[model samples]
Target chain A: MNSFQLEVNIMQIKVLYFARIKEAVNYSSEDVDLPEDIETITALKHWLSKRGEVWANLFSGKLVVRAAINHNLVDDLATFEDGDEVAFFPPVTGG
Target chain B: MIRVQTDDFDMAQVLDDLRKHNPKVGAIVSFVGLVRDINDSAEVTTLTLEHYPEMTQKALQAIVDQAKQRWDIIDAVVIHRVGTLLPTDQIVLVAISSAHRQAAFSACEFVMDYLKTQAPFWKKETNSQGARWVEAKASDDEAQARWTQ
Candidate 1:
């Protein structure tokens, strides 16, 4: 493959958190590269779970979490591509 | 309509905006959520509300759409404020206008319920003890789920 093709093959994914999750993660968002097979939301969480204690603690077990892919609520099987913005948070409490 | 603004709103002006176009409107139900001075037994001095801008507007618009489907309402408006706010300050407002009172009331409550559980907004309260983030309540999900069935 050409160098340009190889560069295009690599994808960037961003994970954002809010409230307690943000505090626990110590970051509002982070960018990471994923293997070609790890394109779904569930797989992404599994990948993030191995990052460290903070991620494992927040994502491990049956924690109540919500996710949005590119600004829309999505199911666990949602797919991602290069430069897709993903967000994670606990249930909302507004109004 | 859904608006996320930092400036405070005038209730009379908003009411007039909703009622001026329709003479058949008989009931107008409105809910104003205030930033309280206390949370989780802590005395809150200031509160900051944060939201994902694009997603927040879309989610609120979806909730308003659902309310429109379930009720025969003439108009609905959702106004939410962000940034630093003090106690007793209005944080959010939901207004519904309909030909009858029950649809207006139910729609207003329904919109608020969906907003509480589905919309993306986080709040942090600062007090003498420092700052504490509010946790998401399980009861909120139950509240929104009731409308599905």
Candidate 2:
């Protein structure tokens, strides 16, 4: 539990895309190692938008996408932890 | 009970089973949602429901748990079918049982309202033109808003 040991622990998370977002991104789920600066869902989304065109379009507020942390719906400001499952999708349309 | 499956559920069998061996069950109110042949003036041939498998069942249970806490309900059942469905096919059923009609009626509607806006299921419509994702209607948000007020 020293500073050097803590620095060796990389933050990893599983990101999921559903429906149209999945289609656009061409990936249903992905594992990403978090950058030290990206601690919140909003920051993660902004970082994801830097990937390329389709990703930028999906994550840059162009398409309305809802997010969930570990299968529970959450706002963009929700903080992320290591090994969490974060999901993004459009509004739900079920009855 | 919450069942998220692709199999079509039989209304009569489901209803009949809910009241069995439970003498206090004096009333049952259920709502069934079916696939529509038309939506937004388009000829919708088929509807596909996609859901987060790990989330759908748990979210449904949470919804019913909320409904039960608010009302004096004996039991509740929620069945939401996923995958591709043809027009006129059954999609969802929300049944609530109680000793009185009022609680049954109110809880049934409450579950359906919450499920529409809160659950993770998404729908896509296929037609002669093409396939497109169904947009979440503002009307649905309005419908759920009524309950909170």
Candidate 3:
């Protein structure tokens, strides 16, 4: 008898939406699982845009939204690991 | 010290606590921002402020730390208010205490300038024309850039 093992790579990340982004998405936060292919922020955004019409429109590169990873502002090219918290929102307008 | 709260702050009490043990401070400069009845050609009756809790605190602390590093100030305090606010309500306050008038004035202005742009707070205005989010001004960015250069 022969036995084989299959390996899989998955990453679970906490995603937060704030301000206008939250209002648009109608969600505050959720945990999402992404495949290994979605490693970077840009890839993740592209992947998330496929969720539905609202997601597609919001992440379609028209909105001037910003992103933060682990509570720190980061560029779209930033990469993430499992269990990281990512946030998206509009430009800050406070003092 | 830094604080982000929905409750209104007392400037006199805050100043008293800030200068309680600091006998070296000679000058205290402060700035208070308030909600206005009119903005951008609209009548603003109520303004609701929103923020990212963790990020907002971190950003405020970082701003104060930068001011401390740049100026020889004895101490500083930043109190920002969130939630629904009516016209004439206090929105933010920045106070800097220093040994001289110059440092206190400059640092206070510097902190306010940075806070306007760097902080992660957003304001939505409810006006006669309905509610809308306030846009970031280029003038604010320019004011902040002057410090970097």
Q: Largest DockQ belongs to which candidate?
A: 2
User: Interface Cα RMSD per model, in Å?
Assistant: 1.1, 0.6, 1.0
**Candidate 2: where are CA atoms >4 Å away?**
A1-9
Q: For candidate 2, what is the interface RMSD? A: 0.6
Tell me the tens digit of each residue's lDDT in model 1 across B25-115: 9989999999887775367899888888869999999999988998999999999998889999999999999999999999999999989
Ranking by TM-score: 2, 3, 1
TM-score on 0 to 1 scale for chain A of candidate 1: 0.83
Q: How far in Å is the alpha carbon of B2 misplaced in model 2?
A: 0.5
Ranking of candidates on lDDT, top first: 2, 3, 1
lDDT of 3 at B42: 75
Pairs that collide in candidate 2 are: none
Candidate 2 overall lDDT versus native: 0.91
Who is ahead in DockQ, 2 or 3?
2
| lDDT score of residue A70 within candidate 3 | 86
DockQ per candidate, 2 decimals: 0.71, 0.79, 0.72
Q: Give per-residue lDDT, candidate 3, residue B23.
A: 90
What tens digits encode model 2's per-residue C-alpha lDDT throughout A34-57?
866787888988999999998899
Candidate 3 CAPRI grade: medium
